[model samples]
Target: MKKVPFIAVEGPIGVGKSSLAREIANYYQYRLLNEIVEENPFLGNFYKDIDGWSFQTEMFFLCNRYKQLEDIEKYHLNKNEPVVADYHIFKNQIFAERTLQSKQYEKYKQIYYILTANMPEPNLIIYLKAGLNTLLERISLRGRDIEKNIDPAYLLQLTKDYEQFMGKFINDHPNVPVLTFECDHIDFIKNKADLEAIFSKIDDQLFINN
Candidate 1:
């Protein structure tokens, strides 16, 4: 198989997207780009009151991700190396739609579209989905203080929103493959079999499509 230049793994919080991205980046020696979750000042407050802090949190992520991608394009493109990232730029719109009110969402969408218009798209996007129970357990195990107050209902809504977002994303960009993995039963972190299975599927998808 011809080497893939870039891959992005995406999922709702606690779905293990970063962990899988790490495994893939390590295996392929690709540059790993994990999203910055703790750096946002509004994140903890957003968890407490989403509506109040959503815009600030979203804008922080938008600006940071834009800068990060710009730097990656410059440095990695020059070196001709591959990149494996935990989050895709599209998440900006997804989370914005969920967190922002109608007026805020419209404004946010305008800014988002502008920022991402010229950004490089990932060759393949691996979206991992898991049941709410699985998400809750994983979130608990990770034990982020800000995440401690996260409501189960909110996570359930996020799961549905992500599914909706992925569906539209695939429909709009048919050329880029979006491999959906249902990860309720498997522990990709601990089980080598599960990790291998995910990578094998990624390999098959890329090879078949390419």
Candidate 2:
């Protein structure tokens, strides 16, 4: 039997990961797994004072994401159901490493590895990337009160971190395909052509190329 496709849409803040994930899930009629962002009690504080709240924020996200992925594996993936997630579990490490102190990061890394050791990996990763200016604009347009205090410097650095992590991910997970899109050039949300173009590429990777 052919394996069910599990696609993860990943990127830094304001990169439209959730939007694309939603579109993909709708198009394929697959299960949608969105990360619990607003529910993170530490998130608002983390955006204001990253150093002071980094550990708490990271831990909250890690635990919740682990539970989410666990449920998806049991109720969806194992049952031959396809799923499209807005964020990948590995992104937790990206933020933790960027904000946590060395000792805190070491501890967090240990927990992350243990929790994710047997988690299901995505068959395909749709990575969206854009300029720092574009990211800031999108974040402002969304007007999430919790994200109002986000630091541009931090967001810029997070983008760099994501790029580096994705580079390493490609090398480590050679069998898993990573489809990248430049969000600055393509407005998949508003333009039908752009949206269809992305869908075409996804179909090519998940079906034709698979």
TM-scores of the models, in the order given? 0.95, 0.98
Q: Write the per-residue lDDT of candidate 2 for residues 1-210, one digit (tens) a residue.
A: 576899999999999998999999999999999999999999999988899999999999999999999999999999999999999999998999899999999999999999999999898999999999999999998889999999889999999999999999999999899999999999999999999999998998888434
On a 0 to 1 TM-score scale, where does candidate 1 land against the true structure?
A: 0.95
1-210, model 1: which lDDT tens digit per residue? Answer: 464477999999999988899999988788999889988888999999998999999999999999888888888944677899999988888789889999989998888888888887788899999999999999999888989878789899999999998998999999888888888988888899988988898778767756
Sliding window of 10 residues with minimal summed lDDT for model 2: 201-210
- List lDDT for all candidates, in order: 0.88, 0.94
Task: Give the candidate number with the greatest TM-score.
Answer: 2
Clash pairs detected, candidate 1: none
